[model samples]
Target chain A: MIQVAVCGPRDASEAERAQAREVGRLLAGRGAVVVCGGYGGVMEAVAAGASGAGGLVVGVLSLSTREGANPHLTVAIPTGIGEARNAAVVNAGDAVIVVGGSWGTLSELALALRSGKRVVQLGGWRIADAEGAPLDGITRAGSPAEAVAATGLFV
Target chain B: MIQVAVCGPRDASEAERAQAREVGRLLAGRGAVVVCGGYGGVMEAVAAGASGAGGLVVGVLSLSTREGANPHLTVAIPTGIGEARNAAVVNAGDAVIVVGGSWGTLSELALALRSGKRVVQLGGWRIADAEGAPLDGITRAGSPAEAVAATGLFV
Candidate 1:
């Protein structure tokens, strides 16, 4: 199964949280493993969605305690590297789907782009260059279904 | 001298590059040392500006090779931790000044905020919460001078 990272903030709105959950559910339903930052908000929502669907959920935590992860995670990786673990999350995912806006989401987007990984934005940052040109290959999806479909994982 | 991190993309535009340079010079003029991702683009520009002003600059490179740092850096520390080295940049800086927008810049901002470090945005992200309130204490400056001054390091 392909690992899909659903990244966003720990304090997102309810709509954004719902979007993340749907994304997680869709990805998991398609036999894809879901990965997240392993904290609250969107992470918790994603983990809960995947777990509710009996899908494998991995939490790459910045803290050193497995208990630090959301209760839905099937596997918890405590890196104790703080925000640096963002790299580990991106590296572990086959593709990354950004659910909403946050500095951490932006970082994951940057790393994914730099590494030439497939990046899909559900409702987050649309970064561009100084000339107003899109720097990396960033795809925008209007819905969770489109976002997971765009990943081409199920195909 | 205080250590300030000047973070942005390695592929910044000419204007953003110039902005980074001025930021570096301003920081150095105040007897402050500059730190960066230690690659190209804004990092190189900041290092150049500081080195030209006879100020000290440290490049915390993501690569293990010291040669990966820009030539303008006075000291090079290669972590080989990939993008994870962003944690090192934030930890080494007494404060951080974001010169432009990028995924890497966004990550640094998040990490700095989480750690409760002083963050000054020159021309980068303007992050807000779900309620449209500033999530963290983000200081915005119109010019590089104002940005560096707002850091309150020279005070």
Candidate 2:
């Protein structure tokens, strides 16, 4: 009954793209809708994998002018908010699954922090300062499977 | 020296991809560092365009586990936070530009609104009113030139 939101770099590297797809498969196999920024890289890979299994995929786009939605997306929630569309993803997910990322990834982590949502970091860079003020309710997993499993157990 | 972030669905249709690439070129020619989810679709397009023009591009990635960074990224800020990466994108940009989208894009949009970032929707849906309250300073543009102009004027 919960949706798993996948967020990552739009121009993800090969390995990142592969990881995202695997994660999507895992989520879809469990019958969760896959949500993402929705154009390419990690987002597209995940959507492609999930949709291949007959899973529903949602995309919240930021195009204010002419950009269009990804073809893999089943539902498109357009937010005329420009790049701020990131907020909707963090909020929509019951649990957050992160794959390969950059700055956008960090912000989504922050959103999870702000929302008190369950956050599981897979394989990427350490964005927060654990030594300083550790994030509350955030758990770090060694792999994608571990990350998704924690969603059922943790938040 | 303001940074502008752009993102969208990864598995974009041909039309979305073309539009994203054009947006990337426009952003680069204007001398702005285009930030993105950092892997594919609009992220790669914007980063390639900006980097090619000697402009700066930063990618905030979510792969703390093992995913790699995009080749076009000049500066990669890996968060290892996974889907929460959306929050990072909204936080990093000085201003925001949106184009085609998905769930992650919506999350970014929500984060931008919460952060009070000025956003210019480019070619997708307009930011909807939340609980009957409209965003305070969102701008609408129909073309890349107008969108960029709006970002400049709004910021």
Candidate 3:
């Protein structure tokens, strides 16, 4: 089964949240497992969407306790490792879907790109250097469906 | 004994590398223990400096094998957890001193701030928000001594 990691900010815009939820729902509908940071905001939204669709959801928690994870998760891996859990979140997925922008989210994107994971950026800060050169490894998705489609999970 | 964490890019500038070494050396001179990511670059330089100063060093390695750690480490923890080990690096230190900037280093700083750990920024990016407001939680230091002093380790 395809495992897709969805990441975003904890304090996100309403539209961003909706988009995250939609992405989760679509991934679940495609018979793909959803993996996330296991906290609130985009992570929670995606997990909620997948769970609502009767899909498996895995939350890679920063804390050692399962209680830190969202109730929607099918499995909560309490890493007790803090933001470092971002690597675990990316490593767990065959592809990564980033919804919003944050420093931690940026780190995950960088790690995913470094590891050669298919990254579908829905709506987030474009990773660029001082020269404003965009990291071309990331594929921009116009919508939630497009994001999941970019992951090539259906293929 | 105080445990100080020194972080920077894996491919560091010559000056940045020297700064890391000095930080380690000073920490060791003050009877403090040095902790780092334990792979290479700044970690290696700091570990070498501390070991050369007859100080104890701990390397929180990302791999499961001890061979992946710098030989200067007194104790190598092969977590085999990849970048998730950054959490382990920050969590292991009483205070953190960042030498240079990188995506991984930025993640560690964010985590350190979230954890309420005293962070001394010697020569790294001043983490700011969208409005360009600097994150005020971090203290700026002019030199290695000042960074360690800012941690209240010498106070």
Candidate 4:
């Protein structure tokens, strides 16, 4: 099954979290496993959404314990390697869907760029500089459904 | 200086979240850097705690589009690599301290074990079963002070 990882805030606001879960739900409905860092914020919200929709959710945990993870996750992969687990999350996913924003989230984007994975950006921070946000040209979705549809072309 | 990484649960029931932050504070007191996936949960919480306690926090983000790191982070390593950003988190930390747990946390643990880095488990899920948990007979600390102290033996 294709894994669609939703990377974003760990303490996301209610609205952003809702958006993340909706994205997970739609992706899970498409039979994709929704993957995340697996704790709170976007991870928990997305897992809840996907699991609510009867989709498989996988958590790429950085700890050796299970203190973190959504109640819906089907599999737990222990990287025992700290941030290196991000690679596992990115590698497992066929496509990358980033939401909200964070430094770790940005790193995930870099991984996607390096891995050549299908990338999509949802509501979050933007990568801007003197040359405007470069990601402005990349795949950007305004809603969960649009993000789902946008992924169809990538897969 | 030691480097510790914490991941899992943003709104982790106040108490749980408190413990994560306390761990970070303890680590930071030793002039160690708190490295994390760098968003929220134990990651942001600990980063906040560490920075509040005058410790350096480096956020190894996984996306480039979003660099919204926690307020405590001193350095934002924007990794525009998607999930591949996990590798940077583990590599950056000198001693990886795991608090709470999740699949992403687990994957990080796996990478740490694969790299043979000194790992300290405060509390969380079990990564191994029949093969046994990585770092068998490893020192498990209940408090952040002990966890940081334990890190000294390895590095």
Model 2, span A38-114: residue lDDT tens: 77788888898888778889987777532666678888877766555666777789888888645556556556665
Q: Poorest 10 consecutive residues of model 1 chain A by lDDT? A: A127-136
All candidates' lDDT scores? Answer: 0.84, 0.70, 0.83, 0.70
TM-scores of all predicted structures: 0.87, 0.50, 0.81, 0.52
**Candidate 4 docking quality: incorrect, acceptable, medium or high:** incorrect
Residue range B57-138, candidate 2, lDDT tens digits? 8888877632556688888887776665776786778888877654456457556755778787755533322122333565
- What stretches of model 4 exceed 4 Å from their correct place? A133-137, A153-155, B1-155
- Docking quality category of candidate 2 according to DockQ thresholds: incorrect
Q: Candidate 2 A-chain TM?
A: 0.88
DockQ of 4: 0.08
Q: Residue B57 CA error for candidate 1 (Å)?
A: 1.3
Off by over 4 Å in 1: A125-136, B124-138
What lDDT is reached at residue A98 by model 1? 87
Chain A TM-score for candidate 1 is 0.95
Residue B155, model 1, lDDT: 72
Model 3 C-alpha lDDT versus the unseen true structure:
0.83
> Which lDDT value does model 4 have at B49?
86
Top candidate, metric DockQ: 1
Off by over 4 Å in 3: A62-65, A77-84, A101-107, A120-146, A149-155, B122-146
